[model samples]
Target: MTVAQLSPQSQVAALPQTWDLERRHQSMRRLVDVVQQLSLARSLEAIMDIVRVAARELTGADGATFVLRDRDQCYYAEEYAIQPLWKGQRFPLTACVSGWAMMSRQAAVIPDVFDDPRVPADAYRPTFVKSMAMVPIRTEAPIGAIGTYWAVHHEPGQDELTLLQALANTTSVAMENVRVWSELEDRVDQRTRELDAANRELESFSYSISHDLRAPLRAIQGFCQIYLEDHGDTVPVEGRPILETVVSNTERMSALIEDLLRFSKLSRQPLERHTVSLDDLVRRIVSAQRAAAEPGREIDVAVGPLGQCEGDSSLLEQVLVNLISNAFKFTRGRTPARIEIGRRSDGDEPVWFVRDNGAGFDMRYAGRLFGVFQRLHSAEAFEGTGVGLSIVQRIVQRHGGQIRAESAPGEGATFSFTLGQGS
Candidate 1:
């Protein structure tokens, strides 16, 4: 063949093939961009907006509709088109091409709407759509459909159909992700509301106990003191012991009320955190305890390098006071009460501990150790309001820390704790 004649024939054949390849390549590139956008979409509305524009551009279609299956009806929720086809409209599942695609769980290609038995002729007669293609959003169980329309009689190429289906599949995942996120947000909101309500109730209860209950308790204690000081000698010998019992109980009641008030205040107070030399704090508390100790009592205290920690100084001091005070109170009968205060090495975190060779408790009761008003020993064995350990626990938790106790009967007790970053 002559060069000129061969060139004409070759050019004619190569031109269409090259054009088709370029079109497919552009469609795929656009699909990639659409997929990226869909992945970030947090709402169904966002997904709809993305798919509407991409569907028409990827297929070179004149119009595209984002359809959702509303029960047995196909709802045209959104659209992007040269001319409006169905922006807000509904049709029976059997009567609409989009609905048919979702119901059958496959893509439907129609070269001519009038020639297809599935498409309602009356519906297409007033519209510009002649040829159309619809793909289900999901393959196994379809939720919706993506429909592309052409004004002229045309059959979509296999490449275009594949790209459209790919877009549809991605849309399904995006929609599911949006649903899951929305549900999670709702659960968090509900939990927050519940916590707020519970906190408000606790505050009200604390206030009532502080005022209403304390006034009467104060009156009882005051009267008992007056009776003891003014009329003590007049009472019969046998009645004197009963009168003393009333005075003793009033003092105990006052102490319990004070402990309760302190416990309540701990929850409302905000933490004033800073770097604190725990060694100094522990020593100061122990010094005060020693000064208040019985004149002849002997206490052997072993203080180690407690080091520095991030925490509220006053609150941390209270924790140490409660633990050390409990040690002194429990080891009353010991010849020389032994108490140890120090920090031990822990992986990536600091662990502080208080140990005492005191009248220790059983390990089985350890779970109840931090609960309010939970005492392992009888009132005669240990004189305490039982709110001290509970207060210690609350302070540790507020500082982003955890407190645990370990002990057995006759063995020393150890209270160990860890503080998080804020602590």
Candidate 2:
């Protein structure tokens, strides 16, 4: 006889009713409510609860279960209204009809579960599900199976199978959305920690730079002064020049220390931006540099009618000083050399350029030009701490600006950099 020919009552003395249309309608209504609730739920636990409740009612099966297929095993992921079909249980993929549904990626309605050789008799006997509808709950792949079952034999017709499949579809989509949300949260948390670590490393680097650079400068200055004071008269003429060299080296070191401190402080402080004239700032910087220059050196300062910019005056002054000093120092060899400090409008804002017929840098070394302790010329050729351009670069960067240099071995350099456009 076919599986259906065997009466459900005859096959199992304790079989459930299969053709109760009124009972089936009530079960399906409860299922529709469950699917709607699952759709609105955000939490995984809530979604699973809806799935289980719907499964229990729709199948009219005494027990229902949700299984999570992990690797090759199907474990009781969650349970529902009925005495569970082996509640909190697990079964191997090679052993049961539910596992077969998971592996095959399809639904199975077994009118007689044990009648099919695929069903594990021992696993089924515990919470007798003689009639069964197993639906795979899937998102990316086969994740698990949701099954509605009977405690005794009852043929689950097509209507019950359809309801079971619908519930599984709802669970699959909801689970996938929740999994994606969890992964995104993890990625954001990891990125935040990485950024915090980077900031701490930068702070440690700054502290080390300060301690290592200034400690030796103090000793060089102290020893140079002591030698000149104690043994000035007895020292030979050749020795005196060497002593003078010591004093010069110490002074240069002191200047370098001051420049480095200034650069470091700039990075930590907040900018005090206000409206100021670019043209006026340049003129003042030029005058001060000329006064500090060897008594007779000329520098021509030319710029268009002043344009107003919003920025920190003190930092801007330092930027102008560094750029102008570099211009003056480089052009020292030319008998009547000229240094021009100028500014012009680029689109809506002013762009500044310092052009000089003085020492120019090689283009290949341009990459290192704006790094602290990065020097293009040797101390023998030009006297500087090499930290000035670095300061200039930082100040420009903090102001959301950009800088560039154009120079060749013999050709004079032109440093062009732009600040934000003035309103």
Report the backbone clash tally of model 2. 0
- How much does each candidate deviate from the true structure in C-alpha RMSD? 6.0, 11.8
TM-score, structure 1 vs. true? 0.74
**C-alpha lDDT score of every prediction, in listed order:** 0.88, 0.78
Tens-digit per-residue lDDT, 1-423, candidate 2: 543777876646323444355677787778778877876877778777778777877776777778888787888877774564555667788887778888888888777877877777776676546787788986347888898777667777777777888788878888887788778888989998998688556655765676687778678777877878998888898898887888887788778767766776776789988887777788787777788888776655454454667888888888888888898889887767677777676776667888888878899999999998999999999988988999999988888888899999867898877766532
lDDT of 1 by residue, 11-81 (tens): 78777777888888888889999999999999999999999999999999999999998999999999998
TM-score of candidate 2 on Cα atoms, chains taken together = 0.56
Candidate 2: lDDT over CA atoms? 0.78
Query: Once all C-alphas are superposed, what RMSD does model 1 give against the true structure?
Result: 6.0
In model 1, which regions exceed 4 Å deviation? 1-100, 103-105, 110-133, 139-142, 147-181, 184-188
